[model samples]
Target: MRYAYYPGCSLQASAKEYDLSLKAVCNRLDIELVELKDWNCCGATPAYTVDPLLAMGLSARNLALAEAEDLSVIVAPCPACYKNLRKAGKALEEDPELREKVNDMLTEHKLDSIPKVKLPLEVIASDFDWDALEVERPLAGLNVACYYGCPVARPKGGFDNREAPQAMHLLVEKLGGQPVPFAYDTKCCGGGIVFTRDEISLDLTAKLLTKAKAAGADCLSVMCPLCHLMLDAYQSQAVRRLDTRFDLPALYFTQLMGLALGLGREELGLERNMVAPFSLLERMGLKV
Candidate 1:
């Protein structure tokens, strides 16, 4: 199970734990992650808003680099990057004119070809040895609320189901953990507006957290760094602003999966997180 791994800028910097957890889990699962050489930013939301073609062109350049490595599938970690790459690939496949324009841009930039882009979660499930991923000491009593923010599984018909996607839920179940249903699983955390409208972002986050907590979710399992930031980092601020108390610990789906796979806490980079997971795991009777 060898594939090209693209750890976007955020994962390399603030989200280093994501990279560490992913590497550890992949190693344990016998999945080889070969990183693309000298990859650049995927031109997330900024480029798409300013110029769609430029965004596609930037994403296509990275795909071209992956093609140079003779890899068909690329595993992207960042949700924003995954959305950009997936959308660019879809746009190029659907619209021939856009494809030619992007290709022309690629030619101008001296990039050769484009390879298929895929999110790590989807790629792992689609093309991996599932039988080998059998659980050792599965999480029996843990309750997780699967949170997939706007970019990862939204705008409909990109990769998976948008409204009620069960990819993460299924993964949680595989670990013997129960995925609790909540109202705001697919709701936006006001990610793009976090910088500009802090109040609205915090309010939205607070609402989601409160709902998830009420729904009996001890921890919110996530896949996106941006969502993790808003839900975990801004949680205290959101609580302060709303004058409410919500101590929901947000864990990366991979991090929780790694723990279930019998990997030690250090391997999952649990210590690097802003939201302390020890109390949450202990509350669930999970040995941390």
Candidate 2:
């Protein structure tokens, strides 16, 4: 199956590992991710908060590009991008007047409709055929806390469940990894203000770290790049701030999946993680 892919700004810069690993995994499964040409940012919450029309317009522009690609689904790697893109697409399809206004702002002109916006994980979990899928190495003894974070299953009923999400657990089982039932799985991670507001970000991340460790999670498996940044980059600081050492690493889910699918470490960008989980993978006899 093929889908229009949107890497977003974070995937190009901070979260390149996620993009690489996701592509590697999908390629192995014979899934084609045709990137939407000349796509722009989905205009995050702050942008929408400042100017609603501009944010929607920006998101609509990307949708139009994807539509031009003759794609019905757009798989976004970043949670923020997926959330905003879905929001814009849904809003436009529901409101004719607003859709017309947003279309006027687009350079591509008339966008009668928008495609479905979703995360890569959702596609894998819901649609992938388990019978044909191969696992080169089982993720045995790996206790993973599937961190859905905020934007994943938020803003009420869209795609995934808000409180109890089980898709990640099913995937962990498929990969031979134990999915730890971690508290605060859907919690927020202080987002883009980790530097500006260290205390809040640290505290929130600390809560997740502490909970994951307590739940016997070897590491936290995250889908969103921003959540990866907060939990991976600021985790050590959160431990220091909390006066406890939670040495659990934050890993992108695709990284683990790629490893299971027999992809090389370099192919998955495994070493690029802030809190590298290679040691744990190596110890578990997972060939890199």
Candidate 3:
């Protein structure tokens, strides 16, 4: 019913729509999202490859802070943050040396090992009563392709099935929507290369969206803000670069869930999207 929420850096800036929609949906669903105060970045992209320990340490600090709170789960919206924290948390829990180093770093800031870290989707889809979610709304008619895209389901330590994740599909079914299976569901969205080698990202995203479209997915669902950014924001560029016209709307899993729960477009932050959901809303018969 209640969980500690970490919006991470992307949600605060690039992914603010996700944060807003999540809060609005939680309010509508009577779920409480308690944001952890003074939570810093989950080390973002820079820390990961350069210094793995520093990345873990930074994530550990945030995790330690969240764990200190009286909550067992921290629902992170950003895949980067979720992956970083989840990997760091697993490392801290299983790898004694890594745990000791992280703990020492945490003590430097007067913190302790805190609650476990997880993506909000994972926690909500798994920990909560699935039957209750099914009763909320029927997402059976809507065709959705679930995109895991790197961090959220990787590292093989956290929750959900590693090879073929069905959690999102289960959630989609709970919301009365049909989940369309696709090949690139767990494939990289070309995230890290988005800024540096943008052409590659655009091409990959274009192909991914094309695959989703070809799979008969009316819309794409994702838990990662970065994935949303790549799929939604960069879509136009991808289309331009690849000389193709694919206008499939990308929806945050929370946004679609909120819509199905009888929430309006504004409530679900549909206005902040790069790829307009007007047609999709029309398909869903939702008035904007």
Give the winner by lDDT: 2
Error of 2 at 17 (Å): 0.7
Residue 18 Cα positional deviation in candidate 2, in Å, after optimal superposition: 0.6
By TM-score, rank the candidates, best first.
Answer: 2, 1, 3
What 10-residue stretch in candidate 1 is worst by lDDT?
107-116
Name model 2 segments beyond 4 Å from true.
none
lDDT of 3 at 62: 79
Ranking by lDDT: 2, 1, 3
Instruction: Tell me the lDDT of candidate 2.
Output: 0.85
lDDT of 3 by residue, 1-288 (tens): 888898888888888889988998777767788898788878877888788888888888777666677677788877777777777777677788777776777663433455777677776776776556434344556899998887544666657777788888877887778898798998888877898999888889988998999999999998888789899998888877766787888999888888777777777788898989888777776545
lDDT of 2 by residue, 1-288 (tens): 999999999999999999999999999999999998888888776888899999999889888888888898999988789888888888999999999898888776468767988788888977788777698899999999998887656765556777788777778889899998787888888766787887888888888888889899998889888899888877888889877775688888888888888899898998888887777888999857
- Candidate 1 regions exceeding 4 Å error are 94-104, 107-113
Going through the candidates in order, what is the number of backbone clashes in each?
A: 0, 0, 9
TM-score of each: 0.91, 0.96, 0.89
Error of 1 at 190 (Å): 1.1
Whichever of 1 and 2 has more TM-score, that candidate is 2
lDDT of every predicted structure (CA atoms): 0.82, 0.85, 0.79
- Residue 142, model 1: lDDT of 90
